[model samples]
Target: MVAPKYSRVVLKLSGEALAGSLGYGIDPDVVNTIARQIKEVAESGVELAIVVGGGNIWRGVAGSAKGMDRATADYMGMLATVMNSLALHDALQKHDVDTRTMTAIEMREVAEPYIRRRAIRHMEKGRVVILAGGTGNPYFSTDTTAALRAAEIEAQVILMAKRVDGVYDCDPLTNPQAKKFKVLSYIEMISRGLGVMDSTAASLCMDNKIPLIVFDLNQEGNIKRATLGEKIGTYIGGELNGEGDH
Candidate 1:
């Protein structure tokens, strides 16, 4: 088997990706497929760390718009991520991949609280680290959490697993004529509000100079392909300079 290009990577999985077509809660078959892919990636010797969003079970911003306290709703969203982390952990274990679920919140019963050193140690030991709980703060997105965690762990790249194939100039579902970018600078993504991630997350990545690969998650084996650096998605980095201009 060919070696992976990146030794360490942070996989940012949208909660919706875990929900499958039903679009709510966990889907066993979907999670199992994801676990099998993760197993392949892990066996390839890539140090994998995952950050899961809570949008499938709870969306804090949406709740806040409906008169709930923003902080409370955000906390609820964090808890939802914990559930996802656990489900993913279980599925991965069935594949015989050693995994650990670490949360930003202090839920000792369900997972270990997030500790930078411990998380790195787990990855170094070849155990997949699942990071959940959204930085343990209100008004912070899971995307930002992924950025902060990836920086703290010094991951080589952030593999953003999206339902969309890549970054498009317009919503592909809404506009069939939308232009897809094969490569984009961070400035382009942020300036265009292309929604690769929230602005806070984008700025964090830019300042750290960590590259991001946004790709379609539903495609079988895509995670392994991304980890192996097969160029299956839009490449967002500071160094591209439109060199491989599409």
Candidate 2:
């Protein structure tokens, strides 16, 4: 069996990925499939930290903010992440994979509050750690949260699991001519405004020298493939000079 290139990694999953083909809300089958993939990686002895988005349940920034403040909307978004985290936690447990859900906010009823030492300990013990609540603050996206967690946990790579197979020059769904990039540099991503992640998240990874691999999670075995270092998507690191140049 192929082993992962890194001993520890952080996987960033969007809420929609858990929704499957329904395109909305939580889907048990999809969550179970993802959980099984995660279990595969965990069983391979890789310490995994997952940061999930809540866009399927809510996007605070995109909600009907007719009378609501931006901060309020963002807080709601954070709550949505907590919900997703709980769901993922349950799914992982159902697969017999030891897991813990830690939130940035104080939600003792649902999960433990985010403590850097505790989170590290969980991973050290081979328990998957699910990070939720989006930094426990407003004005930050889950992308930034994943970057922050990766840096804090000293993870070697960030697995950005998305719906698209990889990063494209344009929206692949709409642009038939959009080209997929195999590799990209932090400087290039920022300069080109690729939106692989928020600027803050990209800058954090750049400064920390952590690599980010963006790939589609909808495909089966992709999580394990990524863990084993298979070339499947756009890789952003400090070494890229151009497309497919990693």
Candidate 3:
């Protein structure tokens, strides 16, 4: 068997990815597929944690634009993340993967409150930890939460699973001639406004010296491929120019 490349990783899942084709709610089929892939990684002895977004259920920025208080809207978005986290936890459990859902918000009934050491301990004990609630604060995106949690847990890399295969200079869906980046540095991404993730997230990873891999979540075995350090998507780290002019 091929040994895993990174022993620990943080997976950042957007809510839309979970939504699948339905586009506005949790799709069980997609969640199940994701869970199966995650189970494979967990069984391979890689410590895994996940940070899920809530745009599929409620986007705070959208709500705020529609006249809701920004903070209140953001709080609702956080709750939506908690809901996604719970759904993922259930799917993982069904696959027999030891999983724990921890929230930044104090919701003792459903999950444990987020604690740094406790989260690390859970991973050490081979539990897949699902982090939810987006830093328990408004104005922060789940991307930022992933970076912060990865820093706290000392994860070697962040796996940013998206619907698209990799980061491109232009939207691949809209531009058929878009160039897909094989690799990118955080500074390059930020300077070019790549938008693979929010600037806050990119900046956090840059400051912490954490690498991120943006890959297609819809692809089967991608999670495993990423963990094994295979060249399956656009890798972002260090001081390198965008290498996608091919």
Q: Clash pairs of candidate 1?
A: none
| Candidate 3 structure quality by residue, lDDT tens digits, 1-246 | 999989999999999999999999999999999999999999999999999999999999999999999999999999999999999999999999999999999999999999999999999999999999999999999999999999999999999999999999999999999999898888889999999888998889999989899999999999999999899889999755432221
Error (Å) of candidate 1 at residue 182 is: 0.3
Candidate 2 regions exceeding 4 Å error are 64-67, 241-246
- Candidate 2, clashing residue pairs? none
Write down the TM-score for model 2: 0.96
For model 2, how does the per-residue alpha-carbon lDDT over 181-208 read when each residue is reduced to its tens digit? 8888889888999888889998999999
Q: All candidates' TM-scores?
A: 0.97, 0.96, 0.97
> Candidate 2: deviation at residue 157, Å?
0.4
| Number of colliding residue pairs in model 2 | 0
Off by over 4 Å in 3: 241-246
Candidate 3 lDDT at 183 equals: 85
Residue range 165-240, candidate 1, lDDT tens digits: 9999999999999999999999999999998899999999999988899999999999989887787889999977
Candidate 3 positional error at 66, Å:
1.2
